[model samples]
Target: MDWLTRANRRIHRTLHARPANGWKPDRFRKMALPPIAPPGWWKALLRLPRDHYVRLFTRHSSVHPPAVGRCIEVAAAMGQVLVTCDGVGVARHARSWASHQTITDPEHTAAAAAARKASAATKPASVEVTELEERSLETNDRIFDVIDDGLSTGEGLA
Candidate 1:
């Protein structure tokens, strides 16, 4: 080794602080410290691209799969509860995919509508032109009363 390296080590050893001069050798020799294990790594690390479905994927399919980035909670004993991303009530579709291979949510309805949009123009339109006679409100007084009564009672007029 270089002279400077040797000289530094020698000086460092001389300058190093030592234990108490009256310390017992037997007690010092008997001193022992417990070993420490490494920290857990797998449970702490979420493998790559944190935004993906890896956080929600179960088996080979994803459950609910988020409707417009919203969380969907479905109970195995109950049914599916799907809401929009903004937490707005969109549509209620009963849990019917029991023992199925894929999950179908409200978002899929839009996709199905888009796929069927191409054929929307293929069907012929049905228009019925009718002539109606204008009548005064006095002619339907009984109907209005019935409707008001139904509304007051929280019941359908029909």
Candidate 2:
């Protein structure tokens, strides 16, 4: 594609300026296959066709051509992850590939971005404690206070 100009140049230089022994087909195969992309390469890969890469996920979003095929082999999670560089995750995104479209899970992206803001990291979101549990805790606190007072006062501890 448009981003492959450098790759094209390198390929041209290698192929056209052949060695005295001529080209080795195996070397050409090695050249055709890319080595690990240095971080952010996934973004460039996104510019290419989806058919060329296997989709993958990180903690915060979806991505293409997973760090390794095994990166996407997990059974849990889908549709979201972070963008990794050099096998270590660096940025978050909601993953989607739909023909020149950018897709993201808004809430997921928000949370991912919030991670950088540190202050936005909060305790696990509140969950509704059953009314019974709420009452039990308050009642237990008062009862313990009374028992504590009694023990201090040398009153009935039996």
Candidate 3:
């Protein structure tokens, strides 16, 4: 057998050895077969544009409003809990809640969409788009900001 097939069989054997709770023996037996890869056309479609998938998924989120609503509710609850536990007053609590809301609220969805559009527009037409190194850098920068914010607020960095 080829390496891929051997690896898949090994995985199947390992998974079947320790069946999960509520797992049916028949299902486990069926799962021993190698997973079928998507056809060439499907792979080609996926390879077309990464942003297409991102936009499609984000659009899907709008179609299912419950996800956004859940996010808002969770964020609000977290903010409220934080304020209550910390014993912060009304104004401070409101500010804290607003900050959390800014990150999760559907109202900021427009700004995020605009930012994505701006980024796509800024891409060099001549060059092929590779993995987003800029986003990785931005993520690292945000981590630094979180660290700095914590340090400044006397949250002792270890």
lDDT of 2 at 59: 24
Candidate 2: TM-score? Answer: 0.19
Instruction: Judge candidate 2 at residue 33 and give its lDDT.
Output: 42
* Clash-forming residue pairs, model 3: none
Model 2 lDDT per residue over 92-143, tens place:
5544444444444455345545554674565667888765534666587576
Error in Å for residue 81 of model 3: 6.6
True-structure lDDT of candidate 1: 0.41
For model 2, what is the alpha-carbon lDDT of residue 47? 29
Against the true structure, whose TM-score is highest?
1
Backbone N/Cα/C clashes per model: 0, 9, 0
Candidate 1, 25-131: lDDT as tens digits: 54777846658754322121222221212222231122222243444332221343333333453334443444533444545445546546865868778989899
lDDT of 3: 0.34
Error of 2 at 111 (Å): 1.0
Q: Against the true structure, what is each candidate's TM-score?
A: 0.21, 0.19, 0.18
Per-candidate Cα RMSD to the true structure, in Å, reads: 19.1, 17.9, 25.5
What lDDT is reached at residue 32 by model 1?
67
